[model samples]
Target: SQTIHQWPATLVQPVGSPLSLECTVEGTSNPNLYWYRQAAGRGLQLLFYSVGIGQISSEVPQNLSASRPQDRQFILSSKKLLLSDSGFYLCAWTNRETIYEQYFGPGTRLTVT
Candidate 1:
């Protein structure tokens, strides 16, 4: 079975600090990776996506950035955190063969104070 993992399941930080979140997948190759954020009581917003190594697409206008450092590994990072950046961050994966299907990790809830 395939699995996706996200680390530091929860985080709380003050304004203006750096942030780094990691996501990785097992049992799959060349999978499409995606980063999403959901505000409290709001729908999910697609932040960034990678179809392959070094191939990333931003879905919206946001300060967040995503990178595929290696196959099966995607990283989301920010040089400085913003209060509005606080949200539930999720990492999801899907393959070209199963474009309609996606698997998501438990997610990381971030709070900026």
Candidate 2:
């Protein structure tokens, strides 16, 4: 069985601080990984995605970036946090076998101030 994991279930950061969020999957290989953010009462917005190691695709131009250093590891980082960065950050994964179904992690709630 495949499982996804996200760290720091909740975070509070001051504006202009650096941010790093990690996500990893177990029992999956070469899976497509995704990073998404959902503001209060808003839909999920795709931030970044990776199809393979070191291959990243950004969906929107923002203050964040993502990297896939390993087959099952994905990291999201920001050089400087913004007030608008406060939101629920989610990590998800899907493989060819389950391309239509995405498995999500518990998520990290970031509060920027």
Candidate 3:
């Protein structure tokens, strides 16, 4: 059984401040990981994805960055957050054999003040 975990279910950060969010998966190995952002009443937008360690694909060029240092640990970071960065951040993982279905963890809702 694979499961994912994300921290700081809700966050409030001042504009231009730094941001760091973490996500980890258990019971899986070398799964494809993804970071998505969803605004209020909007669909999700892919931020980044990783096929393996140190191999990341950025879907959008924004103020955020992602890193996969370990097999099951993924991190999202930003040097300077912007007001537009406020949104729901989600972490998802899917087995390579089953790429069509992805499991998402509880998202982190960020509000830039």
Candidate ranking under lDDT, highest first, comes to 2, 3, 1
In model 1, the Cα lDDT at residue 99 comes to: 95
Point out where model 1 deviates above 4 Å. Answer: none
TM-score of every candidate: 0.97, 0.98, 0.98
Model 2: number of clashes? 0
Candidate that scores best on lDDT: 2
Q: Determine which window of 10 residues in candidate 1 has minimal summed lDDT.
A: 58-67
Candidate 3: tens digits of C-alpha lDDT, residues 6-77: 988999999989999999999999999999999999999999999999999999998899999999989999
Error of 3 at 107 (Å): 0.5
Q: List candidate 3 segments past 4 Å from native.
A: none
Counted clashes in each candidate structure: 0, 0, 0
lDDT of 1 by residue, 21-87 (tens): 9999999999999999999999989999999999999988767788998989999989889999999
Better of 1 and 2 by TM-score: 2
How accurate locally, in lDDT, is each candidate?
A: 0.93, 0.96, 0.95
